[model samples]
Target: MGAQKIVRQEADTVGENPLRLEKEKAEQIVDALNTDLADAYVLYHQLHKHHWNVEGAEHLGVHEFLEEAYEDVEDAADELAERVQTLGGVPHASMTALSEAATVEPEDEDVYDVRTSFENDIEMYGSIMESYREHIELAENLGDHATGELLRQHLLELEEHVHVMDHYLEDDSLVQS
Candidate 1:
């Protein structure tokens, strides 16, 4: 049987949200959350790829770190999706939808050295971080304090991982050039 839409929730319409945020503001917040959700999935997959492909003397450490980071990204993605739903918006779930909505780019399938992977990861994380900052401000200006707080927490976590990745890039670090 061919897949078909049955009970379709219109993409552009806002439903009854318990949060009671104004419709326009809720729509804006939902759009931001969906974008973050899409970016999180992209970052998660990249981290998972690096975790599987990492090699060299520092392989074990880098691999474990990537696993932990990917897990965290997954958690954040879940939160973003939940927030989107709470705001009466459909969360972007399909790969095409997510890829289209994501602002951050992922690296290609080629397996790079750990250092190269970390460099790419750092760049993606930075982009996501910047996006989150804007989202937090957007939420705050819209009087959605809950969403702003959520983004703020995710930003701090992403920043922590980026800091660790930066140290891994240092000349004296184990995963170095």
Candidate 2:
């Protein structure tokens, strides 16, 4: 009788569903999704730029890696934009808007040396990881576990890119020596 009573109480509490968000949480989540979308779009552009311009003997290696990176970034971009729209926010569309709002800088063709590319990629990935961390935290705070998990996966992939690029950067120095 005691166990049955306890189960009834638990079922009643579960039916009450205490985790529903007030309006503020929804607004915060939508804002975060929009900001992340804009940033991801900018990063996609940078990766595509790198993919098109990387040269020398490592061109094939770098080009292939960059293409993969950009593809991932492009997916993130599309997801983010759609997510923003789903939340009723307009994603930044113009190049000027993206450039102004982006945390990462636009890529410069003149600075496309192997060493410079590696260094810039590291910097970009670091910025991206940091931003993703913030987004993950925000999503978690808003009880958006799915978004948090996605950001975690994205952060891990970016970390791997940074590690692989580190090797290339080191190798570039050895070649000069």
- lDDT: which candidate is best? 1
lDDT by residue (1-177, candidate 2, tens digit) is 465544332210112222354446655665666666667786777778778888887789889998998898777777776654444445566777666667777566574776787787788788878888998999888887866887787777778878888887764442333
Per-residue CA lDDT of candidate 1, range 14-117, in tens?
67788989989999899889999999999999999999999888878888999999999999999999889888888999999998999999999999988899
RMSD, one per candidate, in order: 2.1, 12.9
User: Please, what is the TM-score per model?
Assistant: 0.93, 0.77
lDDT of 1: 0.92
Clashing pairs in 1: none
Off by over 4 Å in 1: 1-5, 174-177
